[model samples]
Target: MTDTPSKYLLNVDYGVGGVTTHFRSRPLGDDLHSETMVLNLGPAHPATHGTVRIVVELSGETILDADVEVGYLHRGFEKMCETVDYNQVMPYADRLNYVSPIINNVGWCLTVESLLGIE
Candidate 1:
């Protein structure tokens, strides 16, 4: 065995290990006297228009930032569609958006008719 150590061991920087990770913990206030507050708008509350959750960072009623989270209406439409034929898919499409079943029914019928034409 040689007396020399590896060159890679001497090239490593020792100062990087001493550095501290810094992060801004809170929202910056609007002005010198104003305060910032975090408001969780909804997981089920109104004005969301649908099943959406939002966290709003506000400074005295004026919004600074907003984070929106969706997935509350987690119906597996795509997966359900895969297991059914075109003629059998209309009712499931209605369930995906019940308020617009007529539109869904019409679209489904049109697509099925088009596909049948090519066959």
Candidate 2:
């Protein structure tokens, strides 16, 4: 008569000294689950001030991980920039970072001037 090992036991015959060890077939329970909470900050949250959506995983209100989704603001700027002259690209750049138009304007001007060897 032979004894059948439980499914969780690993049957290993080392030839000289055979041994069987029980192992967990499932992942260990997460201790983080008790310490953390998941939060969705914004698709339409007022503090975000825009259409940006962020999934934040927090450990007691401190952000542990964040996933940001920005597709709603996509204007195909890269595709548009590919079709335009250097001078024409500034306005689109202005639209992209509306809060700081002068910086975008100056940077675009400097870039165009550099390309033409004017500065």
Candidate 3:
């Protein structure tokens, strides 16, 4: 193995007659081994505007990790966009973010405009 810094090293000891082995002892705090709860917060609900699910892992009252899943609304954004005319995609973009939908619309418009070399 590559040389590791002394501070991070754990010494190993081999027992006589190939019977056993031992490693240096290090104490990990209780939280390291504690269980975490997974909480799922919606693809569609009053509190979160619908179309995204947030899964959060909690240790007691503290959040240990969070994962976000989007597009529960539909699966054909790309295919539908390909079939529609340029202007037709505007309305679809507006619905991307229900909370601040106009932002998504404007951002999509700007991107398309820039790509077409329209100033």
Alpha-carbon local distance difference test for all models: 0.72, 0.72, 0.73
- Model 1, residue 29: what's the lDDT? 62
Which residue pairs in model 3 clash with each other?
A: none
C-alpha positional error of residue 102 in candidate 3 after TM-score superposition, expressed in Å: 1.5
Cα deviation of 87, candidate 1, in Å:
1.8
Give candidate 1's whole-model lDDT: 0.72
User: Highest lDDT: which candidate?
Assistant: 3
Per-residue C-alpha lDDT of model 3 across residues 40-110, encoded as one tens digit per residue: 78777667776778877778899978887777677577887899998999887876676899998888889
For candidate 3, give the lDDT of residue 24: 26
Instruction: Give the runs in model 1 whose Cα sits over 4 Å from its true position.
Output: 1-34, 98-119
Considering every candidate listed, which one attains the maximal TM-score?
A: 2
Question: Candidate 1's residue-wise lDDT over 6-95, tens digit each?
Answer: 456366532346554222355456444657766877778967665778888788879988877887689888898899877678888787
Off by over 4 Å in 2: 1-35, 49-51, 69-72
